[model samples]
Structure formats: C-alpha cells, structure tokens
Target: MADIPAEGLPPADYAALCDFLRARTGLSFTEAKRYFVDRRIAARMAAVGVATLRDYLNVLRFQASGEELQRLVNLMTVNETYFFREKYQLDCLVRSVLDELARNRRPGSRLRIWSAGCATGEEPYSIAIMLLEQWSRVDEYEIEILASDIDSAVLERAREGIYDERALQGLPAHLRSKYFQPVRGALAADGARWRIIEELRESVDFSLVNIADPRQVQAFRGIDVIFCRNLLIYFDDLGRREAAGMFYDALAPNGFICLGHSESMSRMSSLFVPRRFPDAILYQKPAEGGAS
Candidate 1:
C-alpha cells in the first residue's frame, strides 16, 4: 500500500508483470484483477525494500537466488480450500470411478490417485478417509495418494496435517471424530485445533508441484485418477491445454481426470471422453487400443 505510484501500476508495467506471471506459473489475470495484483506486488515490494515497480521487476527477473521470486509467488497464489470442499466428487470417486478402475486391476496391484492442486492437505486427506471408510476392497490394493501444490508455504502447512475448526466445516461430526484428534496441551482445550491422526496423515504424500510446468509434471506417471478440481479455471486457454496434455501423458490408459464442477474439459481439449455417472461426470482418457 505504501510507495505505490499515485496512479497505481502503470498499464504497461501491469501488463508486463501479468505476462511474467503467466509465463512462469500459468496464472492469467485480466484488468478485473488489477487491484488484487497491484496490492500483492506493492506488498512484496515493501517487504523487499524496493521502492519502485521497475526495481521490483528487475529483482524478479535477474535475482540470482530466486528467493524473492518464490516469496512473490507464495503471496500471489490462492490457497482457499478446506476438507471435503466438494463431497459429491468424492462420492463419485468411491462409488463409481474406483469401482470401474478396480475391475481392471488384480488384487494387490498399485492404484495411484493424485490431488493435483491440494491446498492445506484437505482434499487428499479427504480422499484417503473416503477410501478407508467407504471402500470395501481398499486393503486389497496398494493405494498411493499424492497431493501437490505450487505454493511452498501451503505445502509446508499441508505436510504438517493440522487444521482449525473452519477447515473442518464440511466434514461431518462423526467423520471428524473418527479421523482427527484434538491437538494436545492447554490451548487445545477449546478444541480450536485438531491434528489428523498419525495413521491417516502418514497415508498421504505431499509435495510441491507446479502443474503448469511440463518438466515438473513429468515426474508423475501412471496415475489412475487425478483430482484437479477448481484449479484449471485460473489458467489461460493455452495453459489449460498444455496442462491437459501433461495430465493425459501422466495417466495410464483409461485413466480419469476430475475437474471442478463448473469446469468442462470439452471446452478446452478433445483428448478426454466425458463419462457420466449418477453423482458426477468425469473425463476419461481413451483406453489402450481404443479411439482417442
């Protein structure tokens, strides 16, 4: 808020900054987001003691350590997520998607599920809980749950697996009691904080991943189901297409991808086939030896 130009970021400078972010992180911002962007940049500049927007840009571009850039990124990325944010998708996953995928796998085969934009550890942890509580054959297979995000700060918080009451709002009382226990000590008496039980926490693996980066996404392969809900909406068309291609490559034949309820793969790419179920519609990659 301090030391910003009286007129705010010059249009040219704003455009340049937006272009830089889109190139590096696949986040697209229009004029509508100018205020949000301006505020974040101004805050970061103040933190780093850069008095001018041009000087901040130079730091982002030429800084050898890349620490400031990471800090800027940490501030800009959104991390508004909570446990079971969309319960229908999880119901669809356990009730239909997993059942369909398991039909093709033998007992003891590995099944990998990814939470592509997991924030604060809730989404993937929700998935793990669903499988353990609802799926009958969960123990028959080797299950791997991987949750990732681009924001290092959120990833660190997610790895800690602690949540306050608000983050657990979507969870029912029974499920909360079953899976999470109150944090110890005097301050926890009000039940303001809860830590996921060690067993459930250890079941999920958290990592820092930028879904927009082709090189970073290459490490994820043979994933059976990908829960990328609510994330692609932030990307520009080109970024969305690139991400779709990367996901297609990472999935095994006949693997599936789940987007937010409002997101439609049909609008972005023709590579996935939309499959309808009672609870939700999911996009699936073409099976091996089948038409794409």
Candidate 2:
C-alpha cells in the first residue's frame, strides 16, 4: 500500500482505493479516478466521518459488511459506454452469427447473448438493432439478450433505454432518427419525460447481476456469445482465473467470448481458442467432447 498523505489522507487516496477495488471487483482503474471515485465514495466517507482516505481504508480493513462490499465495487466500476460501441463487433454478430442462422434457417432455435457487464444497455441494444436489421426474417426464432450489471442503479437506467444526445456519437442518421427522440434537455428523458421508443425497449432485458457470483446465476448456461468487455482490469490473478473458469463452464460448445482489448485469457489459455472475424477479434470455447 502507498504512504498516507501529510494531510492525513493517503498519498493518492483514489489510487489506494483503486488497488482495493481491483482486489475486490474485476474492474479497472483509469484516468480521472479521483473525480470519479471520490465523487461516488465521499458521501459514505462523510457519513462515517472518516476525514482521511487512510481512515476509510482502516474501516474497510477492520469491519465492512456485505452491502458495504457491494457498494464499494458497484460505485467504483466505470460504466462509460455508448450505443454501437465497438461497431465492428456488432457487424461481426450480424454478418457472421445471424447470417449463418439466416442461411441455415434454424427453426425456433435461439441464439442467446449475454452482455455480461452491460452498463446502461448500450451493448445489448446495439445487439438488438443488429439482430433486427440482419435477421428480421427469423421473426419466429427467439433471439434474446440478457444484459446485466453489478450496479442496480445502472441496470435501472439501462431498462429505461435512453441516452444523452451528447453521448450518442457516430450514430447513423437512420438509427438516430428512428431509435431515439430528443429528451428536452438532458437526453435521457424526452420532452419532460416522454418514454423510450417502445420497440428498442422491447428488444432488451436488463437486470442487476454480479459476474463474481456463480451461485446467483444457475440458469446462465449455453450462452452463444458473452460480451465481458472493459470490465476485467481490476481483478488480480486469482480473480481472473476464477472468472475465466466460470465463463468456461457457462458457455456451450462453439460459444464466443469477447474480452476488452487490454484483457487476456492467456493465463487460462486452455479454456478458449482465439479466432478472428472479418471485423473483430474473439475467442471460442475450446473442444467440448472433442468438437469446438
């Protein structure tokens, strides 16, 4: 741990907190940390009268409940995502996954995707748009996306299916005009609380789910694709190993796993086989019963 600051705070209080969080959650720390972490944790600090960051650490070190533990991870994890983020992946999903389904025409056979850390619904919604655009012919087949996050607040926001006008970047004219309507000022709530376009909202299912808890997700099996992006830099070696194992168990044969650019399944190399799509990079579950 770093030294405490002369002002009784830790020398890089947020940095220390970041270290603590990585050990606790599988999320990462990045720039603007103080602005982000402090702004979220300060209220709890004030409530406890823990004037110094070091003092707060002491309490966490000494006595913290399960709820406190959850709050720490939920608040610290970043949820900065946008619609159609990593567009190449969406394109790959369209042309590769759905395209195969279209040609083969699997009857009532479903393709299940899990946006494992879907923050504010962007990933899943983008996926919905892709499915709608590319596989409209498969209207009878169920293509359900299970979008989840550790943060309940974020899950609630995701369920709303809205965004700030500013946050939407590079959105095509067709999508912007069709999917979103102007929220009077903030962009999340339109025209003094007009609702999200019901069609987009219907496409996604959002919920609070923590990836670390395997017991909480008994039914999370046979997923076709798992998007666990930009949410793994926080975990230490042990955490990553355990998470990778869980992901392996959760996936069916040939199911794809997408990690953040910075994250690697290298340590658990046996569990997945790296493969490249036309516009994206992905890993598939390795030989299940000798066939991938």
Candidate 3:
C-alpha cells in the first residue's frame, strides 16, 4: 500500500471531519471519496501549518467570523464545468422544452431559468445563449437567468465573465466568435483569452447560494426550468432528498430539470418523473402534482 501523507487525517479524524462537513454543507463523504476529502483537508491544514485534523476542526468550529469554514468550503467544493457541457441536454431544452413552453406559456410571460450550483456561470450563460439562438423574437420575450453557487470565489469569477481558452473548448467556434471579444490588457493573455459580450454577461444574475440550506434555497420559486448538473452526486441521501424536494417546490408545475448525464432522481426522490427526449433524459415536476 502507498504511504499516507503526514497531514492526512486518520480514520477517526476522517470520520469526525466528515460529520462536521455534512452538518454544515449537507455533503456526505463516503469511503469512496475519502482520498478526495483527505487531500483537500490535508492541503488546507498544511497551508495553515496545522499538524492534526482535530486542530483544524477546532478552527472550523470555534473560529470567529467563520472565515476558516468558508475557506474549507471553497477548497472542498468541486467547480469543474465548461461551456456547452452535455450539448444534447441544451439541445433538448432549446428544441423540445422551449417548444412546450412557447405553446403553453401565456402572453408577456418571461421564462425563468435557475442554474443551481452554477460554478463560474458557464451553465446559466449557456442557457441564455441557447435561448437567444432558439428564440428569434428575443426582444418580445423576457428571459430571466439566476445563477448561483455556494462558493463566493467562483461567483466572483462568474461575474467577471472572463475565461481562458481552455474553458471555451466545448463552445462552438461560431458562437464563441459571435459572443466573445478579445481582452486587450496584461491581466488577460493576448489572443488566447476572451470575455463574454456585455449583452450576454448582463443577461445573467449571479449569487452565492447553498442549496442544502432550506432557508437560502426557499427564495427560488416559480422557476420554469432548473439546470443542476453534477451537484447531487456530492450530497448524502438526506441532502439529496431535501434538495430535490426544494427543487420540486421551486419549479412551476410542469417545469423541467436537467441534471448531469450521469445523474438520476430515481431511487432518490419521487417528486419528479423521468421524461425522455431523443438526445437526452430530463425530469419534470408534473403539472397535476399540485405543488409537489
């Protein structure tokens, strides 16, 4: 077996750390995620020159201002996302879902889209771009995009709307050229960098939100669709159930949900029914369910 790092949490410490994190963030760390949690915690501990996990836990629990806890959360939360991820899902949203909306929605009604865990704003911005692409009469229809993430750091970046070339990899060349312009300063690399256009950047509203916190998430309601991809996989059963219920309540009746390609609401909650499209599978809060 490989040797454990000196800063690595022992079994008991690991268990305690998991409990601490779960209580605050509602994210459960199973044995399968042990290495990931360990590495993140160990690195944070090392940065502060802490020798034991117990000491770090004390800092998290008793520290004034809760800065340490926020730091840990920022480090622990995964923010791996790119433009136009899971293209088929976006395609379905633009084609099938929007078709349903256009037919059913009343006149002068806006489409409200929430991108939960919208790290760095790619998902919500993608939604906006897709809406613009699919809807020709853009000026006639209002589009409201609310993008949120638990990590404040990522939200700041999302608001900036600047990305390196790597983050633009999945974005189509034509769309990228049309929507982004080169940044002309030392802060960004010469031709390899781009920033979202003012119109598209302003189309989204970014905020800090913890989906596990019922009080925080309760603010989201009457949403026409939610894009919460690769997020529930990190939560425990309780967390998943609670978040799913919140999502169910947040949606307008018949509103849709698009999760990560690998994620499913089955076995987790009965709130949403599976809806299949030619290219993707989605979940829907039934119109007949009477507010789930």
Candidate 4:
C-alpha cells in the first residue's frame, strides 16, 4: 500500500524500485501494499549483500548472473489460491455449464477444461471432483485438465496432490471422509494433513508455464473452458489486454472463458464475446468467431 515517491526513495528509491516491479512482474501497489513488497523484497537485500533496492536491481542487471532475476519473479508473482475458493463460480458451472454441456453433449463427447494459473492442485482437483460427483461414470467424457503456473516450486507442490484438512472446512462430511486420509504421524502432528484421493489426482496434468511468453501458447491448445480466476488482476491494462487476447485465441469456438470475480472483458474483444450468466459472467467466442 506504500506508494512513496520513487524519486530518491529512502536508502535509494525502493518505492521507485517497486514501480519497476510493476512493469517487470505486473504488481499493482498502494500504501498498504508497500509493506508486503518491502518485507519480501527486503529479504533479497541480505542475499545480494546490497543495502538497497537500487543495489539489488544493479546486481540483477549487471552482477549476479544466476538466481537473481528468476528468484525475484518467483517471489513476486506467487499467488495463494485454494480449492473451491469461489463457490459462486462453481455453483454457476454446476447449474449452467453442466446443463449446457449435457444438452450439447453428442452421442459421445468430452469436456476440456483449463485452469490456467492453477496454484498447486486445488482448482483442477476441485473441478475433477465436481465432475465425478455429477456423473456415476464420469469417465465417459474425455476430460482434460491443464493446470499451469510460472513457479516451478508451486508446480512441483501441485504435482504432489496434497492439502490440509482446513481445505475441507465447507465440504460435506461424507465427501471429506471419503476423499482425505487421516495422517497421524509426526506430520499429522499438525492435525491438518490431507492427501487428495487418487481418482482426483489423476485427472490433472501440471506444467510450468508463463502466460506472457508466446512460446508456451501450445500448452493451451484446444481448450474448451478456462478458469483464469484471480490471476490477471496483477497485470496492468496493456498486459491484461494482451493476456486476454491470448486466452481468446486459445479457446475453441464457443469455448467459455471464466475470469476471476474481479475481472471483465468490457474492452477486450480480440476473440471473446462476454456473456452474462445468472451468477458468474464469462466470455465466449461467438459461433462466427474463426476456428474452434
């Protein structure tokens, strides 16, 4: 939340340094945000042996060749997301999307969903479980869940397919008992250890991806539905526009693009048409919009 003038900021412009981070990593800031940024970036101050942000940036640019910039990006873009984080969106999907998919399902068809920026495995696993709950034989449709994030650390953790019991706070007792194992070892000492059932874990494929880079575009291929929630708020207007365009192109014809509750496509029209639903609003490419 701190937006102290970047000009000659204390001990050499840490405030201005944050502005640089806004462009580099797409973090918006204010006075309250300054504390989080200062606390996190200041940790690097010790690593670089530099007393200031200016020195840190200098090292990243000229001196340190390894673990400098990459670590900075990791530290900056890491966002905390959890399974069934937004009940409203899931409700809309269960009510509207599922109905549409059921009605639209051909004799035999699959549903493809991409949880872009899936932090750990929560979101995709949530989707898989929802589908399983809906259909006794959920495997009938070809379901593909692509979960991606820029951080390798989180990606590895997501692959582990583990969580804490706290994630099941709102889950029905039957589902919670059915899905999670009661780990009671030294680790279970915390009383919050959780392991996602094998059935849900197998439904998703995880990968290290940067949405900004064009090279990873193929990772989003043939996506029918996207849950790009809570991630894009980090980007500035221009970055948001570019990222939205990429998603629109990645989605198939009539494919649904779900954004965070805070996001919208009022201006973005490169490939998506905003469609209002009863609860959650998503963008879809019109039938006339190019290739599916």
Please give each candidate's TM-score: 0.95, 0.78, 0.91, 0.82
Residue 79 error, candidate 1, Å: 1.4
Q: Which residues of candidate 4, in runs, are more than 4 Å off?
A: 1-24, 28-32, 51-55, 58-66, 98-109, 135-137, 267-271, 290-292
Per-residue lDDT tens digits for candidate 4, residues 229-288, read 888877767778778778876877778888887777765445676777897887886667
Instruction: Give per-residue lDDT, candidate 3, residue 62.
Output: 94
Q: Which of candidates 1 and 4 is the stronger one according to lDDT?
A: 1
Best of the candidates, lDDT: 1
Q: Per-residue CA lDDT of candidate 3, range 1-292, in tens? A: 2233655657887888898898888778887788788888877877767776777888899998888888888888889888988888998988788778767766577888899999888888888888888755455667789999989899999999988887899988999999999887785755567889999889898888888888988899999889999998889888898889989888988999888978888857888989898878889998886324
Better of 2 and 4 by lDDT: 4
Better of 3 and 4 by TM-score: 3
The residue-by-residue lDDT of candidate 2 on 70-127, one tens digit each, is: 6666676678988778788778777775555345546677778889888888788878
lDDT values, one for every candidate: 0.89, 0.71, 0.84, 0.71
Model 3 bad stretches (over 4 Å): 1-7, 48-51, 290-292
What C-alpha lDDT, on a 0 to 100 scale, does residue 26 get in candidate 2? 53
Q: What ranking of all candidate models by TM-score puts the best one first? A: 1, 3, 4, 2
C-alpha displacement of 197 in model 1, angstroms?
A: 0.9
lDDT of 3: 0.84
